[model samples]
Target: MDNNILILSEGMQTSIQDLGRKGYRAYGVPIAGAMDKYSAILANKLLNNDEKLPVMEMTYTGPKILFEDATLLVITGADMSPKINDKPIKMNVLYEVKTSDVLSFGKLKSGARTYLGVKGGFLTEKKLDSYSFYEGITSQSRVNKGDRLRIENYEAGMELYSSKIKVKRSHFEAKKLEVTKGPEFHRLTKKHREYLFSKQFKIGSLNDRMGCQLKNKFPPIKDQEIITSSTIPGTVQLTPSGKLIIMMRDCPTTGGYPRILQLTDMAINQLAQKKENDMFKFDLESSFDFLGRLVFRFKD
Candidate 1:
């Protein structure tokens, strides 16, 4: 049936994600977008779809899928061992499926999220200037069993397939993330600053869409009081007991804690690839110059 191109057999936390909604962060709306933008981009590239198309951003593993019609698709993210009708499927490369061929991915082998792209992209509604943020009022929620995702039918001789796509994967090995000093950097004592940088910190399990917990190896920071202020992603906020925490993609629009260090964009991307039980180090750079790059080109 051309009425639908893709069918999600299971949609646990399946939300339509785009490139995220900027400019609305000032109004307290968190910059909601794909958690693993790299994988999303890879999936789109495999299907010859737009980079901003709404794909199934599945966390952990993913639900089963059954297509009512044949279409070209790709899967990216954690190695979930996707299978079609009990037959293993190749990841990152596009595949043409027949009707009623069941597709399912096993539990997460590594990483935190997976991206699934459909031919011609997933048809979804948008708000503001984006179709990514589904936390608020949005047309699609996380994929669940028996959910039908509508897709556009293509004319003959317009099918695009890719059995080989340039898909790059992150190399995981107890990672070390380099960071720059933050706004409240001076609030720390000489001893505290040294400990904050050099000591080994442990990642706690209470991580989610908001932030993650890090156990402080050194002494605690006594009663530190700081006014609430604007915070960006990669901000490492400190708690009362000298613990470290990092803000993720869906972090609050504002936070009051002191941000001791900030991870670089590359480091954040690496952290986004990490899953539970994966630990990384926080390192320091000797010097940094913010004026090195001119980054004022804003897009809509």
Candidate 2:
């Protein structure tokens, strides 16, 4: 009846993340869900848990786990060579872990982040009706070494399930991330704006929950002054240092940087699929691309 997952060892940082709160970014509340949101959904869906359930968000690596009792679990996003008791378990599939059978994760093999989910949700302090926002939240971290995740027993004795879902290689090979022209699209120089939508830019390394910086050719922004108004996750702000910062899951609500272009929801999801140094180009448009972006949709 009682099945709680205990953390035995951690990698760099891992924390409990749900789907994150909505309608709060206006108040500077970032939607702090799993970095790879689709991966989390896959984990949750594999275990029949609600999409909003708190799952372990593991970045780069994951923690060793000890189950208080038998439990069901799944993992998705990024290849971290996750194994159970020295035996590798296929990712994107449901699996069983007996009590004392440790679950461990190794260094990142393909992607940057991964999600580990159990049949029941992770027991963590829920603020604003969610257990996300680890950076601002002082007490918890995205799964680290020596952490514990309390869960409940969903399946009784002799429950064994195993299957692997191999995400198509093309999904990982995507190179283009489309975006809508920013609200201040008209503010940019005619030439600079034109060059932006057509030219391809490399996704930089200065990226995290906060945002992502795209490399620029000595950017078009020469000044540093601007009126701070509203912003969202898709906002692309240009800093004085000539870096284009694309806001992500945990971005600030307002900033003085010159807003360049805003990624559409589809593009944002596509952005999550991007690897370091991935070169991408976005087309400029007068309106948002509302439909026909199925590939960019984050799916389980």
Candidate 3:
């Protein structure tokens, strides 16, 4: 089938992403997926597509896309001022596009990433059981200008609805990130532990998909090194120099620094929307409270 959409301008860092490649960490593969999974899932959910269906993950700026065929889609996460043929469109709402319709974005109003999900999802190349784009793992890491993105054909007569959702503003503006004690959390001195939860840490300029570094540092620990151990997304490591690193979606599978805290999945999602120099505090959750919340969620 002919490509359904043409990329006129490849935004800052547009890429294809879904839930990510699972079960490959043992082979040293990073789970390169959408930084904000919650928004991505909402995009797919509104379009009635599979939650894991690949969507276009646009960064600070957004790509200018020309639809070659009619399709249903939804925009979620960041408010980048999306428009169709120069007409402004709302985020978290279902919209229909016909052949030749041009979709573009303007100045970002909130959040760092945006998700564009079409009905039936993008028909992109899948590697390692996922369609997420990653350097060395996927053929292309990010979409380039003039790229033709293949998408499933829209059924002309399919039922469509005017659906919209109101996402909480706090989801983007909140400054507190809930975290749990990591395997090495107890190694820190009582003073250091108190300091971690007491101050707001600014995101360093080196933040990216791999991890986010905090500008504020804790006092250096006497023995900050640990034997390289299994690490996952949300792992917060403390380096010997007192630097704190919060692992993100594309972080390595293992690390040697002291893992002092782990952000909850929701906290990770919240952190994904933050940008350089954004200040946030860590709200440490007790083990008992964490388990209680988990049980309540499962029951619900």
Model 2 vs. true fold: TM:
0.86
How accurate locally, in lDDT, is each candidate? 0.71, 0.73, 0.92
Instruction: Report the Cα RMSD per candidate.
Output: 3.2, 3.5, 1.5
lDDT by residue (tens digit), candidate 2, 235-265: 9887777778898877777888877788765
Find the 10 residues in a row with the least total lDDT in model 3: 154-163
Rank the models by TM-score, top first.
Answer: 3, 2, 1
Reference-based TM-score of each model: 0.85, 0.86, 0.96
Better of 2 and 3 by lDDT: 3
Lowest-sum lDDT 10-residue window in model 2: 286-295
Q: Which stretches of candidate 2 lie over 4 Å from their true place?
A: 136-138, 157-164, 221-224, 273-275, 283-288, 291-300
Candidate 1 residue runs with Cα over 4 Å from true position: 1-12, 139-141, 155-157, 163-174, 216-218, 285-300
Residue 122 displacement (Å), model 1: 1.5
Q: Which of the numbered candidates is closest to the native, going by highest TM-score?
A: 3
Q: Which is the winner by TM-score between candidate 1 and candidate 2?
A: 2
Flag clash pairs in model 2: 10-144, 10-145, 13-142, 14-141, 14-142, 14-143, 15-141, 15-142, 15-143
Summarize candidate 1's per-residue lDDT along 123-178 as a digit string, tens digits: 66778787774556466545556667776564434675445654455433336876
Q: What lDDT is reached at residue 205 by model 3?
A: 90
